[model samples]
Target: MKQKTIYLIRHGETDYNRQGVVQGSGVDSDLNAMGQAQALAFYQAYQHIPFSKVYTSKLRRTRQSVQCFIEAGIPHESYEGLNEISWGAREGKMPNNFDNEYYSTLIKNWAAGHTDYPTEDGESPDQVAQRQKPVIDLLLSRADENPILICMHGRAIRILLSWLMDESLATMDMYEHSNLCLYKLQYDYDTRRFTIEVANDSTHLLALVMHH
Candidate 1:
């Protein structure tokens, strides 16, 4: 009955993130200056945790954010499952008034529990859930008695957490994560369950904010 833990981290900010553009599965983007700072802070904050494995998305932003952990001598793995949702045609496109309206309507439908609402070339909420479930299961199964660190995009993290917690995608939308935010989940082998210890904690970011 050994305990297991999973540390879920959202990658730092990107240029597109700052610009409020949809980055979907377009060409990978690197972190901005603030994002680099946040990633470094994340490393400093959790250096003592002794993570058994570090996982990150294939996207550049997530990989870069966790690069500090690799430099610190932690072994890590990357998975495409951890990548953000594909925005299809909207990838890297700056949203105009019309685009904003369309995106907002899509989001509103999703928020109202319409998981199957089709996006022109984007994945629906249910589709995201389906894709992430296998990855979540794999991570959970491998976390027998060790702690794992997962670095991924914001939307991916949210969808995975929603599935893990058995909450609806609509309800999960209420939770927002800032760049490099860290979330902790502890699992009880005896009960075969996991509980969230912390959600979207950005204490390290706050400290960096205060310092600068």
Candidate 2:
């Protein structure tokens, strides 16, 4: 029996993130300065992990968050299935604005256990999980290539983990995912099961965000 390990990370923060704007799959943003520092800090901490491959969403933020590893000559690929859930009409809206009724409602509803509820023209939690199925399938198929790193979006990361853990998407929010935080999963080929080894760890980035 073979064992495989996966290191999962969420992309660092972007300008939209700092501005409290909704940036679902509809918006493609780059990592801000602090985000870059976070990414670098993450890399320096885990540089010895001996990852054979890197996987990222087909989005700039995810790519930029792991740019350090890419530049270091690690082989990587992008998967469209790993993109964030779409926010549709609310893509660029600020969270606290006076007129953003639907956005607020959506958040409240999602938190209130309406995970299947969708904003107008957007994706529901179920839909996001549906699309993410392929990425999961691909990872399972490549279990022989152990110790791969995946950089993706926040919401998408939660969805993927839920699927792997055989848990409900509603429970996914129980996990915290700060920028550059890592989640590690171990797959046992013999039983064809995955176990969570680490969840939402950011200890490696303490120095980067500490108050001076």
Candidate 3:
């Protein structure tokens, strides 16, 4: 049976992330200095993996997160379907008391299984999952691309893993992640099944701790 290895990671942190501001697909923020360090730490650790291809969301932060791999001349592609969920009116809003309350309520709703709920003019979990289909299909359709490296957003990763693992959307939060964290999965073509090898592993970032 043919098997493929998947290395999935969330994009590095951005100023919006540091400032406690919301950054959605529309924000298009860049990574901050610490975020860059984290990226380098990850690349230095995993560059030997010989990734057959690299994938990232259309968002700048995601591409920046994997810039080292791309710079190494690895084939790379960006897909809008992998972009972050839109926070709509809240996108880029600095977290104030009201915004904090709003986010709490939003999380509450989602936890209650209202996964289809969206912020005003924003995207729902279900909507993001729908759009992510093609990129996933493209990755799976290629036999030559093994050990793929994919970089995307946090919430989007949570949602993506929910369906990919056949878990209910309500439990997506179980897939906790941090900037540059990696989730490893194995896909078996013969059984048509996916098995998780690692979840939210960030041990690669230990190098950064030594740096400081």
Each model's TM-score, in the order given? 0.93, 0.92, 0.97
Clashing pairs in 1: none
Residue 190 shift from truth in candidate 3, angstroms: 2.1
Candidate 1, residue 46: lDDT: 87
How well is each residue in 17-128 modelled by candidate 2, as lDDT tens digits? 9887878888998899889888999999988888888999998999998898999989999988899988887788776555377766766787777889986788998899
TM-score of 3: 0.97
Pick by lDDT: 1 or 2, better one: 2
In the range 78-192, model 1's lDDT, one tens digit per residue, is: 8887788876778898889999888889888878889777677778768878877777778777855388898988777777777777788877676678889888988776887
Error of 2 at 88 (Å): 0.8
lDDT of 3 by residue, 1-212 (tens): 89999999998888888887889899998999989999998999999999999999999999999999999999999999999999899898778898888888888888899999997789989899999988898899996799999999999999999999888778888899998899999999898788899999999998787887
User: In model 3, which residue pairs have backbone atoms overlapping below 3 Å?
Assistant: none
- Where is model 3 poorest over a 10-residue stretch in terms of lDDT? 13-22
Candidate 1 TM-score over all chains jointly: 0.93
Candidate 3 lDDT for residue 162: 92
